[model samples]
Target chain A: DAGITQSPRHKVTETGTPVTLRCHQTENHRYMYWYRQDPGHGLRLIHYSYGVKDTDKGEVSDGYSVSRSKTEDFLLTLESATSSQTSVYFCAIMGGAGLAGGNAYEQYFGPGTRLTVT
Target chain B: TQLLEQSPQFLSIQEGENLTVYCNSSSVFSSLQWYRQEPGEGPVLLVTVVTGGEVKKLKRLTFQFGDARKDSSLHITAAQPGDTGLYLCAGAPPGSARQLTFGSGTQLTVLP
Candidate 1:
């Protein structure tokens, strides 16, 4: 409900091809995250942004890059699509903790994008 | 790295039955959140527990944070088909509130 949207809801591409996924948020939240969900692995963070022009790598950041030039948009890029990269990618936005007075900060998510690499 | 383990990787139960899913971690968490995700959709936050030993109820769903803040549980009463989805638990280690580590998740199937 944080008004998050991911572009190209589904995509199919061949190996060695480049791909980019976009995550746009309408809430202007300060923190944005990119995660890939796979069976057994659950969801692993790919990248995250703390603010505009501020981005950091996550546990499974290999072969991925991200940029956040605007407050409402964060982009995740796969330098070369691989079979290992096939998974559902989710974008989430955090509005900060205690906005509602709780110690935990809730993250709003987008519908997600399913990518297939052949 | 903070790791959360969700038990009962898969559960199948008839509608109106009760069920509970557990999320456990040896590391103390500053806060924990539960999320439900349906097919082809991202996870939606069901509830968040921050204080140790806090319990919150949402309709027929009950969520409890362990007194040590190292574990949590989610229970559903009279489950319905609408409750069929993947339940994931995410936790933030003490001091860090946004960088989350998510559990493997429990896939619940509530049969009609």
Candidate 2:
């Protein structure tokens, strides 16, 4: 909620379709992350970007991809969405220097985007 | 994969009662963080505890990192209706300061 906004707050999509979620941050944080929250899973990281175009997979990277073309925008793409992917997606940005004495570990999360697949 | 497990998946307590939620793991972590999420909203950071056996408090909520750095606990005193929400614990594994492993979380409902 700290200067972070996610687009398409709620979406209902059918199976076998492609879906993309967008995360925009006004703060120029160097690190960005994508996570999914389900009923039994608190929050699982899908992917993360240390900088523009520098991305890496997270614990639950399968069936998902991410890209960061600009510093302020990070996008998560679900190729051929499945019912298992239906969950609340959240985007987070790592706080930069001067925040909490430059620890850079605290994450600020976006409002979240809920995707329902049938 | 390192896993953080939380206890009491669901809790319903009366106002003015005290409760404690736990987050345990077999893997050691460099630091641990606590967060609370409300309905239809993103999780908000509550506290971060570093160092073995470290303790931090925020008003009525007290958080303690385990001596082995593999577990943590959150204790709340005189709970109120406003405390109803999902509490999550996340740990930062050593050598990766940028990443975190989260627990399933404990859903708390404090009835007035």
Q: Best by TM-score, which number? A: 1
True contacts kept of each: 0.76, 0.59
lDDT of all predictions: 0.93, 0.92
Second chain TM-score, each model? 0.98, 0.99
User: What does candidate 1's lDDT look like per residue over B1-112, in tens digits?
Assistant: 8889999999999999999999999999988999999998999989889889999999999999999999999999999999999999999887778888999999999999
| Best DockQ among the predictions, by candidate number | 1
TM-score of each: 0.97, 0.96
Worst 10 residues of 1 chain B by lDDT: B91-100
Clashing pairs in 2: A1-A109
Instruction: Tell me the TM-score of model 1.
Output: 0.97
- Candidate 1 shows a clash count of 0
The predictions' CA RMSDs to the true structure, in order, are 1.1, 1.5
The parts of candidate 1 lying over 4 Å away from their true place are A99-102
Chain A TM per prediction: 0.95, 0.93
